[model samples]
Target: MSKKKLWQSISIVVATLILSFSAQSEEIYTQNFDDFDDGEIELGDGSIIAGTAASIQGGRLQLTIDGQGLGFSSFSIPPLEGSSQGFKITFDYEMFDSVGANDPADGFSINYGGAAMGELGSAEEGMNGKGVQDNLSFEVDTWRNGDAEQGVNISGYGDGRDLNQLAFTNGIILDDGQRVEGTMEISWYPGKGASFTTTGLNTNADFVDVETGAFTASDDHTFIISARVGGANQDLFIDNLVIETGAGGDSDEDGLPDFWETANDLDPEDATGDNGAEGDPDNDGITNFDEYENRTNPQNEDTDGDGLADGVENGTGDYDGPEATGTDPLVADSDGDTLLDGVENPTLPWDEDNPEKQPGTDPNQFDTDGDGIGDGSEIASGTDPTTEDEADENSYRQNFDGFADGTTDLQDGTVIAGAAAEVVEGRLQLTKDGQGLGFSSFSVPAIPGSSNGFRITFDYELYDGPGANNPADGFSINYGDAQLGELGQAEEGMAGGQAIENISFEVDTWQNFDAEQGVNISGMAGGADLQQLAFNNGPILNDGEKVEGSIEIQWQPDVGASFTTTGMNTNADFT
Candidate 1:
């Protein structure tokens, strides 16, 4: 990737504000400490009366006075429904005074929880409460309690009294706050419950920001801002505290639910997010919805959009037309064929091996058969576009027409041998009339390139003799090194070619007595025996009959050659 050649647009939008959702209530509230001017000093909703020791002094609501005694205070608030925005609470406060450096006894808390102020407000327990346990709250501890996460002595990954940690008994926050702002945000959705994030700053600019992740919200709760001082040395004040909420509902006004917007880049909030299910953004003729359902690109008429409509090349609906191959909507010919991917792969019946045979041509090759013909032209021409020998050098199917009647050679390089080797009616006939174990072999010169595998196909007639009862002389098909001389030898079975490594398919037909006709094959490790085979139901041809078939042979380095036959006889298809 060259950085200099880069030309792209990138932008990141941060959600500084809460994401708005449909809400049952639009109620919102706030207090900037200016509400203190309303009348006598009071905090929150005034549901829980302020303790005598907890008073407003020098402006800020004093949760503890002159560090003299235990003090607790709370503000009643409208209870929020679980289905609403639930609530968002924010506040600012200053922790002042000097006392025990690491274990100061004076501490305060701002909690919005299930515990009631009436029970916790008792002087012996309530008004003097420093913290109400077993619930969620923000604790500002100016002391060290060994494991206190905010202990002054604790110094690792945002730990100190300079900031508050949002502790939880039931919820978690997704995104937490940073430093410098004692700003904490809590959001609770209807069924999803709530999460809290606490943040604060100090003189050194060092602070803590923790998110309480999220959790299920259960039961009802009120608000409290309390402080407790064991001695008269430290004081605590809280100011600018507020809470608000709204309905948490759907985002997009589309008559569909969020789950239905599974289409690519479909925004749930904007009605315009959908161009229309029927619209063809890619102009590929396929509707965006159909493309979505088919897992194609709607934005790109041609997912591979290379000058071709996705449909033109990919076929319509489940029907992959002739050109409807799995071509990229963005790339014309994924296989690099000048013929176009759609030309190579066409829509066809679903087959596990469809991909392997798609386009009817190699997507990357213009001439899959290397016969100097374009695949598109070949495919359209109604001829084999993949078989190199579909036509000979003269562009005609090679059927031995050029063999010159008595010759022993085929235009396609097939070399025939045997005293009886001759061209009869365009068929290279390899036979000897006065037969006694007579045979002939045809070795063609084509790289079949691998000893690993090769196939030979041809049509032939087994002369079963004119009489329906007359016995017939049989022949054998042989394969070995090409240099193997005469494909047949007098009476020593099928032999020839010095230093030869050969294998043969013997079609025995001297059916005299009970010596029935049979077909057996084997490597030249002597010869194959029908009885030695696990099964044999072959030589399925009567004397003097024609049949067409293919012989495929595969070789393993140390295992030599193995083969199978696929042929058509008058009786049935042998596979």
Candidate 2:
């Protein structure tokens, strides 16, 4: 043959061999229990298989049967050895008809000796084993009524008999002998000899091989799949049989097998899942095991193990006395204040606004008074902390009567009335009354206009005299004329004529009660005297009639002028 043709044939043969080996590495077998398929001696068709009828639906196989008297089925396969290294078995089944029957003894078994068997029977009876060599069987039983004896055999069955009952108690069996579906998955790890079984049919129960954790399978052995009829006429159906070998068995591929990983509470697939080992579990710059072993918070790094973290302590350099700044390891509050250890001292400028600052440290910190200025400043200025400063004291004046004297009588002969004193809102309110009356005076500080003079307000009441006409009169304001104050006039005697009154005017020295007729009394403006006077001209009777009043004299002290008043009274209630 030509060299080129020979090389081509060789390349083709090598490629074919590679493909064949790759295909052989992974193998799968499946059987659908259709009538056309066999179900008899070698799983042939048209034969009443001993066990239940297994069917396939929704990508899974199902076995259903009645646990009447007893039911059994068997199958055979080639010898299995290294192929058991990584293998998986999966199927789905359910029993729906278990009423009036002996506690639904339906189950499927995988035997590794030489055969596999599935059994359904009364809770008291189960399938007889069929192998004798080193064998392992996985059985999912529904009832536990069977005797717990081992290695016992019944007639018409094979070997390796053990009266171990099934583990599942509930299932769904169709009344029409149709198939009931469920899922059963089994995985084996060859190296570890460990196996795991998960079944969607009976979720509560999980079985594991006691000897070799490796899952058992039927190899060159008679694999019997069976079920028992609780009643004589009970029927069963089975379908979708699948057997496979050479599967990578590791579900998570995390180096650890899924079975072992699940048992040890470790994530098989995630290399970093075991945070207790090397990695930081809390992500606080500390390992989980270290955190568990040491009393210190693994997340934090305070040498003294104080509640305050090391980083936080060092960042703020306020170390309390005797406790070294960053080295003594004593986590004491830097300030002498009794706070938690490692708490930064707010006395330092760094944390001035901190709430931990000593109380009353700054009166301005919390202002109880709404005055724009803080209480500290107010106290410093000798001002009332609770009251606002009056805008202008001169605008209004209050008079005190008999305040200095000990007598409380308003009719005493020596009782004197002084000028109007303390005032607010253009009105003066006093707290004393003299014999006749009392008064206090306030000089109006300077203002800009000649027309800006003063107003006098007083509360007056007449008692026991001619109504509005007696010789004894009331109050008046004298402006420019020392005798006539800036505003207001006294009323003729009258009883019960009490009211608050106000009068305003410009002050002129020439405007006097005795001035000449044609002389311009309105033009004199130099430092004129403004006075508020209260007087009575009536005859002094055995018992004199009295008038009680509060007077407010308001004047601007623009020039070198002073004010005085008499016959005024004071009361705490101005209104």
Candidate 3:
């Protein structure tokens, strides 16, 4: 092969290799902090060491506070790129006494600043004495006391001026049998300052607004895991130290980091600040996702649960039962009857007047009688339910006269007989006993359909009277005319008359000279006149004579007309 041809083949292979390497570089960054066993420093200070202290498994390193051994051990990595921004640091740590009694002279700190460990201040030295510059450090100190002036400085870097502190007073101490297990997280926002939270120490609190400038702009920073114990009497245990950048730890994706959630007793997986589990906590069968999305009670079986639900119980009135299969829990009864509350009784058929009795009560109760309806039905019909049944006529009836006109008589005999008569407003009234001897007259309206022919019937009696010296006084019927007196006049021997075309028989057994007749008059039109006749010189009966009777006059009105009566009986009575 020619040298030029060989070189071309090598170039082709090199291009393919470059492409393959580029493809394999898809991952951003990954670290579980489990690489300490290899005795290799992937990044950061080769001086930082790892070993086990208080536990079987080991992932801890130590740094002396005398400022001589392992000066500022650090772990460094490149920042995440693209729109995928932010970085987080998390770790677990414990503090203890090296010689068996509590030691107040030991401390440690984790710092992030520029890329070199030299940028981190010494752990045991006050912030003022350390030459560290341009950095943020969360220090755990066991020596500093109430001097808020020197512990965990937030801004300004030197002793007596350090603005933040996590002094001995703030450090958490475990009992003989207890252990400190906690996490600390620091999150860096692009344009915003760092935010952090610490647990198992002090108040186990969180804070933001540190003075490290903006974390996003400070790209190449080092992570230092360092500790110091002055006077050689303190020891510490560290486990589960983790450093993570980018996003997967937030299960809820709610922007709050996972470390903060664990420290705050909040569920990292729950976006709603409710329970952490994925589905309904009450096992009521509702999905937690749906509940959260819909703003419903994820733990409750019913959402609006007014005994009703969507798609089934609307407008049915049986809201208490299962969905559509049951009745609507609303309307009382759309049909206006007293039947179904909902379901099978959409058109309530049960009579409201006679509502169905409750389960154990009388089923056949009908509050209204004879109407074939119930009390509820009466109410629905707008009638009085309580008084719907017929009233007791015998108990309510009143007799105007001393005599009982039968207990069933709605009107007793207070109205008189053989006097002026008229039906006023559909009510009939009468006055008896002639006011002017045999010369008086009375009038009654012409009833409908009473023309061409009609009849009037009545009963009478004469209590006492001397036999008439001449012809007996009598009565007569007239139609649109007068002078029809003595209607086939009553002779002395005759007690009554036979039924005629429009006249009927009469009775006169009282012997008071006063008399009455059951009379029917036919062929009367427009108006009519009735008269009482006096036999030659015969006097009318006295007022002592009493009579009881009823009269009905019938007519056919080819056209409307009036009726009147002339000459009243001198003696008339009622009982």
Q: All candidates: CA RMSD in angstroms?
A: 33.1, 42.7, 45.5
Question: TM-score of predicted model 2?
Answer: 0.30
Question: Candidate 3, residues 308-376: lDDT per residue as tens digits?
Answer: 232343443332333342432222232222333222221234334443421111112233233333344
Which residues of candidate 2, in runs, are more than 4 Å off? 1-26, 34-70, 80-82, 98-102, 116-131, 144-180, 191-203, 208-223, 230-236, 247-575
TM-score of 3: 0.30
Of the two candidates 1 and 3, the one with more favorable TM-score, higher being better, is 1
Using all chains and alpha carbons, the TM-scores for the candidates as numbered come to 0.31, 0.30, 0.30
- Indicate whether candidate 2 or candidate 3 has the larger TM-score: 3
- If the candidates were sorted by their lDDT against the true structure, best first, what order would they fall in? 1, 3, 2
In candidate 3, position 268 carries an lDDT of: 72
> Where does candidate 2 have its weakest 10-residue lDDT segment?
514-523
User: Cα RMSD (Å) between model 1 and the true structure?
Assistant: 33.1
Residue 20 error for model 1, in Å?
20
Best-performing candidate as measured by TM-score:
1
Q: Candidate 2, residue 293: CA error in Å?
A: 39
